[model samples]
Target: MTPRSRPTAGGSTALPGTDFGHLTESTRPLVELDDAARIRSIRSERWIGYPQARSVLGHLETLLSWPDRQRMPNLLLLGSTNNGKSMIIEKFRRTHPPTSLSDREQIPVLCVQMPPEPSPSRFYLAVLAALGTPIRPHSRVPDLERQALMLLRATKVRMLIVDELHNVLAGRDNARREFLNMLRFLGNDLRIPLVGVGTRDAYLAIRTDPQLENRFAPMTLPTWTNTPQARSLMASFAASYPLRQPSHLASPEMTDYLLTRCEGTIGELSTLLTSAAVLAVDTGAEAITPGVLERTEYLGPTERRRQFERHLP
Candidate 1:
């Protein structure tokens, strides 16, 4: 009899063959818990598929299925930090995760982070690492390029997703140009869709090369505002929390309060809700309320930074 190997997610043992599916380790174990335990369970990280994200995911599915063409289709997912860009990409990846085919594991989508500084060496290294390909640290550009290209093709990667593409904005002009050229060359060489996820600067980065910009269509996820859809988003999100009573998180005052606390980003909003829920659990409230929100450790980005900055003199 052969033993089965379990997967690791966030360092916890996961069921064999489980691909870290949408339900995170944080929220998966509370299938039948009371409100208090549910609050703690609901505090886990989760995916909230708002309208824009669902539409973007649908477009990504189309791109992945696109037949190979001279000018391969690509996407530039532009949005503010913590506005759910990465989450959308992550959901897409999970949907088309690696699968074994004819003894070869085919990674339909490959997601990698753009390096802090844009350099060909770093770019190749990141790709190689994603593929779990070991390499000599001092390998030359040509060797690394050949190695990366071979692995990408062998893995049958249909889509390459690069997150935090705005990091390229930090590189110098020559490096930036080279990086953009590399992107164009890769699409031409591999005939695979390239999905770039980053802040709005990522669109600007792609635009630097008119040809690349033309090849990749732009998709934007704007910051949240007080709207019916936004309120609905809040309500849908709040329903998932384990609370004794309905939170009414989308009520006028609550909506404004959450928006301000989240700094208008869905990611921050999610974190704030998690924190508030957890605090409520600790305090026996079991529901998110203005009092619970006030007691939460959650802090908006600007305010959090301001706190640290104030003590630095």
Candidate 2:
């Protein structure tokens, strides 16, 4: 056969019928899958689809409505790492926008994640920054507190949701005491309910401050353990991913596999399911399958597992 003539440097060799409009969808990077939209999916049943989620939301609503209840109960949410604490708060924020709450009420739920072993001054600065208050990078602790209080007053934040409350106890005794005192003031002085969320250690930290303990209503939300609710949650999770494995949809075997892999934590399960979906999409599969999930190893090594275990049930 005669060789096809090669186009010169500037000449076009493109196919005559090529249409740029029909470009195939590119594969989305797995890392990019952790964006706010996908991870904060409230529609996913397998993860946030648990019965306890409603209970938590209801408790939050109660606090919002009865902010004046002299008791001013603080909520203590304890669970294992990867236990859906963050997701629950994210979903709550999505469904009940903070802007709406701030307009109608003072001390609306202000969700904040505490830094690991942060100082009282650092904590105050973080709160101020989170509330969008002006703060000098080198400003003094007292200045930050003044600004924070002003922002709180301006925003009308009724309740504060402090995630990873265990951080308060990570500091020195003086630091810990100061943090606790700040919490006391945020609750008693401002009369705003402080909802602290963390792993099991959060419970232990509260014990250090009896006053905080007195004001707090400890609510433990553990990972599912061989229950009907767990299966139902899995079904919901499967529904959220349009490309979820066909075998996993409401299947007992898939539920068991998910439970075993994620160790009953809806958060971990969601992460795994998302990974599996991305993998399926990359491999040109229309749906996720048991094989695809098994092929995608999302969990970490033994050392990482130990780190996660420290925050477990």
Candidate 3:
């Protein structure tokens, strides 16, 4: 067969290419799958792109089009733990997957997790690895930095996303200052937007340096509440659960239980629904109800954090 006419792998399209157009604009992809495929889809990790997530994506898209950068604008996306910050950024990244250029990939958006402790060398290492260009195994800091910056340019990276930026705060004061300075230099050097994503502590970190603080416009994903938007988001999520019966998650009783159990965070809410959906499938119930949720063993973020804190000292 001609290369252009290569057959799809074993014709096994259990997922993808389904008529998911009926789903809400954000979740329409889920509508394409049959029940079994939908159940499998729910089990895997995915991005929901809720309202807050969409807003962040819009901000990043705007930044991508900014002209030659002097005083380039940056973004700081901060929110509570499990409030969907990473998901938002990841969704944006997926929407712009890498493209093949002349014998190399032109990664428009390069994202890396901030090291648990801040160090310029470690930051460079993360970026280099993400770009598939590892520095020498035992290279010095300056060498790693040089290679990373060069590759970031060569690959035409339009945006640099450092998730878990708050981790810098765990390092010493001087280290934090150095990391922030490195970020400033990187932004100025690359002339691309630098997006920082983490909990509220990330805002505190960025605020330490007046220059850095001034550059990043802040966007926060506040905890969800019992509002129409929140209910709509929940409903959108439940619609993808693959259950035969509607979960009616937006009903006041169900919504309150879900919010209370999920601690009003999108990540937790998603996990809870996914877990309940999987269990429903296993039990042959084919639907999520208050009884199913009650039987699920998932714990809310607050309770889980409390449990960990109690064991300390």
Give the top-scoring candidate (TM-score).
1
Best of the two (2, 3) by lDDT = 3
- Residue 138 error, candidate 3, Å: 2.7
**Each model's TM-score, in the order given?**
0.87, 0.76, 0.86
Backbone Cα, N, C clashes tallied per candidate: 0, 12, 4
- Model 3 backbone overlap count: 4
Q: Poorest 10 consecutive residues of model 3 by lDDT?
A: 1-10
lDDT scores of the candidates, listed in order: 0.82, 0.68, 0.81
TM match of model 2 to true structure: 0.76
Which is the better candidate, 1 or 3, if ranked by TM-score?
Answer: 1
RMSDs, each prediction?
8.7, 9.4, 7.1
lDDT of 2 by residue, 144-184 (tens): 77788878877877778899988777888887887888888
Model 3 residue 88 CA deviation in Å: 1.0
Model 3 C-alpha lDDT per residue in residues 1-313, reported as the tens digit of each score: 1011222444322333344332445445443344466578778886555676787788899998888757789999999998888878888898899999777789999999999999998898999989987468888888988899888888999999999999989999999999999999999989999999999899999999999999999999999888888888877877766554466788776788888888888888889999998887677665677788888889887788899999999
- Stretches of model 3 off by over 4 angstroms after superposition: 1-38, 306-313
TM-score of 1: 0.87
Candidate with more favorable, higher lDDT: 1 or 2: 1
